[model samples]
Target: MGRPCALREKEVERVFSTPTIQQINSDYAEFFNLVGNNTGVDLSENGFRDITTVVDFLYIQVSYRIYYPPLPDWTTEGNVKCNNNPIIPCKDKTVYEIMKEMNDLRFYVMYNSTELHKLDGGSVLTDIGKKFGEYVAGNRSVTYNIYSAHDSTVSAVLTALQISDAKQPEYTATVMVELHKSAGDAQGHEVKVFYKPITDNSSIEEKNLPGCPSPCKLEDFLQYVKRFEISDWDKECGNNVPTTPAPPSTDSLGLTHQEKITIIACSTVVVVFCLILLIMFVRKRSSRSMAPYLSLGTGA
Candidate 1:
């Protein structure tokens, strides 16, 4: 591991000029830390691991709601509207105008489910143990099966692994698998798997760890991440992703010649004012020094 660098306040300010981006990045790190703490898992340990491979997936679940009319009327008008806009339409009736709405509903369900999964997955003890094993294996340069995923992803992995307890509430768990090898022992290898419950406010707290590598604020992290994502997209999509041009500035706002002249004149006036003040300050100090000398000469 490289030596950690400490960033001063001014350095942080210089790196992250924009407040919003700084806030977002801070929040993101905080969220990650919180998840780690709640689960009693230290993801930072994994940070030290030589991460050779990364796999990502989503876990999914379906929910249902019963459709009922206001007056319990099953007549054609009521039935048509109900069929057309049922509170919860059947899988087949979800078509045409309702398709967009259904898609939106499904998206929301997936998002919420994923969030819940992350929360639960973070706190599970079994998951943390498996993660630690993976970390050890990675550090030892062993070809180990390691997995890190969100809640939905965990559920899906568990289901795929044919783990019996893969249901909600009772079977909720953070699924993990790992392989490890002993240092300097080519043939010494170990494989492990486990699951744990998701909990809130889980995180591993670090004391005396090296500070941030650079004087990076939240904005700096955002810009770094953004550039990374854009570069990745460019590599993946080739020519499909068009490069965006920089936006026009104040100079490109179609200002008239006279307005431009006025702005320049105003800036010149401010500069002149500052120079005048500086000159006056120098003169005042000179006069004050001379006053004492003149008084001493007259008294003598």
Candidate 2:
């Protein structure tokens, strides 16, 4: 006798007809249609159905594989898959790995091109629609308002901006945001963004200078939809004008020659002091042992 099939035709049909499954399928179809229409990509209903099924399966498989423990309880002698493998398991996985996995899954499906995979036009319609909406009204423009943060944040921001690929140390994301407005009404609109990292005490001092304003607060960014304001041609807004300061002989923090010399001298003194103490301790111990041996020889 052959083994029975896991799902019969009627049973499969019944599962698909369930309310939860039906709602998910409807949502998936709508998402596919939206992306395809917005990006001007063509996709068929069958293709959409197939892609949806594949994505759903991948999500389930990955989630289960990554989170399911070999042993559910100590009482059970044999190793077995988790009975209720939740999408997110708090005890089994680290928060960072979970976040990374989620991000990878999202980016992969969201950015996959239909042409490359011979997917129907509807495959990337949802993502394209999201991108379009974001480009038009979202805060895609970089903001330089963070003045204090971890180095990882700085590295991430730099990566996003196509700056240096160097990994920053912790707490280096402190940066200032500068916004530049468009030149004239005829030119439509444009904004220039600038970010400066604040790493040391000197950077903090520069931030507290007389004229330079602090980075806009998070609340300010949230409240103000537009970070840049239109420059009035009549009044001097100083948007286009370059305000150059006198060139310093040293670095921007104005560290004078004397200050540099003093710092170097202090460092040398501290090092020499430690060396002298170490030598004195060693010599004193050596001299005591030699004197005792000399006395013993004379007595003998």
Candidate 3:
């Protein structure tokens, strides 16, 4: 994070040398850069320390407004703190406008970012597909399936299905998938999915699961959902190199088989030559010592 321009460079390196802190610093810096470039604002003063302060404050404001409408203006609210200053004026923008802008930014980051959507959303999609598969296969006896997930979770699922139009789901938005059976239909079972809005209860936003008919057959629904199912989530998550252990090397410190063979042959030949020389020396020494005894005996 380049010492944050506030702390001593050496101290920052010493205190935040750990990988977790480094990652946090890295993410904070990226966010500051992205926001600063996009909004032309100075976030350097509170880059890592208070980057999310305003957003958090907005969430609180929005929360309070749920029960009590007409809360204080978010753009000119005293709740936001940056550089320890409150009530910063952001010309002529209101709470609703700021909220919408934030949502759009979030949608762009979580859904429109293709690689990120795939990497982050892939596992969630796979899990849901497996859950549905169990129900279709008659293994699960449950009458209903309910998924409680975050906005990003729902958007990621949609992104993985290649049906995301990259818009923020409104507050308390939900996507519901229902499975049913009927006697009149040729297919044994059928499926219908709806996007229910929080703003209006009467809206029934029925959307097709790409390449499938509305209220598709249970078999077709199963097959269509399986398209997003991954065999292994970890394999497709990213370019993580597999950590398989390699087999033991046989060559012994990089000596080839031919080199070992030549060395062994040379050693064997040297040993055999030494044995022959030793035998000849023993026979000659015995003969030399016996010559003196033979001469003494012959002197008689």
Best by lDDT: 3
Scored by lDDT, model 3 comes in at 0.55
Selected candidate, larger lDDT, 1 vs 2: 2
**lDDT agreement with native, every candidate:** 0.35, 0.37, 0.55
Instruction: Report the number of the highest-TM-score candidate.
Output: 3
Say what the RMSD of model 3 is.
13.0
Q: What is the lDDT of residue 188 in candidate 3?
A: 72
Model 2 agreement with the true structure over 256-278: per-residue lDDT tens digits: 77788989999999999999999
lDDT of 3 by residue, 182-206 (tens): 4577547777777775555678678
**TM-score against truth, every candidate:** 0.22, 0.19, 0.49
TM-score attained by model 2: 0.19
Model 3, residue 247: C-alpha shift (Å): 10
| Tens-digit lDDT track of model 1 for 113-157 | 222222223223234344444555465454434444444455433
- Looking at model 1, how many pairs of residues clash? 17
- TM-score, ranked from best to worst: 3, 1, 2
Candidate 1, lDDT over the whole model: 0.35
User: Of the pair 1 and 3, which is ahead by lDDT?
Assistant: 3
